[model samples]
Target: MNVKSGSAFFLKVIAILIGIAVLAVCIYWLPAAARRDAIERPGDYSLYPLLVCAYGVCITFSVVLYQVFKLLTNIEKNNAFSELSLHSLKLIKKCAFAVIFFILLAIVYLKVLTQFTGDDPAGPISLGLMGILATSVVAAFMDVLQKPLKNVLDEQLKND
Candidate 1:
């Protein structure tokens, strides 16, 4: 296979693997962590808030991954420089923002709850911060890419 198509193939594989990994985390890790939280707090909190946060995260990240897949498809079709790919990048950035929003909301929720429970919020807060940072970086990357793509499209329009 050619270098371009080969790269797209590899990226597709990577994206699928990432989806699987996230599914596993949602199925396994989240439940275990929730159980631990319940055991530690006994009756201080319900899992519903955490579940909502997880649901938001999963939804947004899934959109990001779907956008990545669409972007790769555009690359394979030689349309990576076109409006469709730009739209995909825009959507991915939006998804990143959604993820950040959810993380911040969850952090705030945890902070308020911990204040009442007298529990240390450090652990979850730190984790949420890291998630926020990561999501912000993804949004920034999409912003940078979209700008170049817009510039290219503008230049092409002028030439045409």
Candidate 2:
């Protein structure tokens, strides 16, 4: 295979691995954390629902990665300038926005909980803010990328 195809394949593999890792975290690590909380703390299940929400966000993130894989497949098939690629990018951007929204909601919830219970929410709130920043950057980057890609697609259509 040529370098381009090789790189596309590599990216596909990486996306799949990331999906698997996120799945494991959602399925195993999240539950374990909840179980540890229940066992060790006994009465504090306040963060349990937030953990579930985080898992939901992670599942959405995996869907975004799958969209990326589809986009890469289109590129490998020389269909990068097609509507399918545009759709994939749009879905990825939407997913990134969804993640940011969820993180923002989590931050708000944590802030309220801290206000009520006087528990220090610094670490989790900071992490949620970081998540918001990262996903916002991704959404902005995707918007920038979409403009040039849309131009390319339009140009290709005119040429055809």
Candidate 3:
């Protein structure tokens, strides 16, 4: 597909919207659930670590989103589809790194929870972490596919 086409732009916009929704869920629902569970269980601050993990993921996702948007802006400024495709691939690479980091962080949090002796109340966080990991995997594949597209664009641009 043409990276500079309207469809690509539309997909990017959709991704941004999904990111926003995830952020909103993290900010509102995640905290309230953690707080409630903490209060109900009293003496079990286990949720704290999970909450922290969620926040960390949220922060990283925000950064990823910011970087992606910046990349999009830069791509839009380029005259050739090849240049834009390359920028998008780079952004996806960064996003994959961020996702992997967050997944590792989540795993660490889960391990810590298991060691501390308490309820595994961070189900939402764990689930969200998995979602991010899956997303990153897909994004990484896209970046890989973009390599050939970038080459094609480069050749086309050279001819022009």
- Could you say which candidate leads in lDDT? 1
User: Which residue pairs of candidate 1 clash?
Assistant: none
Question: lDDT tens string, model 3, 23-121?
Answer: 888879997898799779989876776677667667767766776665666566664355665766676677667666666776777767766766563
Q: Worst lDDT window (10 residues) for model 2? A: 47-56
List lDDT for all candidates, in order. Answer: 0.90, 0.89, 0.71
Query: Can you give the TM-score per candidate against the true fold?
Result: 0.88, 0.92, 0.62
Q: Which residue pairs show collisions in model 2?
A: none
Estimate, for each residue in 26-145, the C-alpha lDDT of model 1 and write its tens digit: 889888888898889898566669788897899688888888999999999999899999999999999998999899999998988888879999998999999899888889999999
Model 3 vs. true fold: TM: 0.62
Which model is ahead, 1 or 2, in terms of TM-score? 2
Choose 1 or 3, whichever is better by TM-score: 1
The candidate, 1 or 2, that scores higher on lDDT is 1
Candidate 2: which stretches are off by over 4 Å? Answer: 158-160
Query: What CA RMSD would you report for each candidate?
Result: 2.2, 1.5, 4.8
User: What are the per-model numbers of colliding residue pairs?
Assistant: 0, 0, 0
Candidate 3: misplaced stretches above 4 Å? 1-13, 64-85, 118-133, 149-160
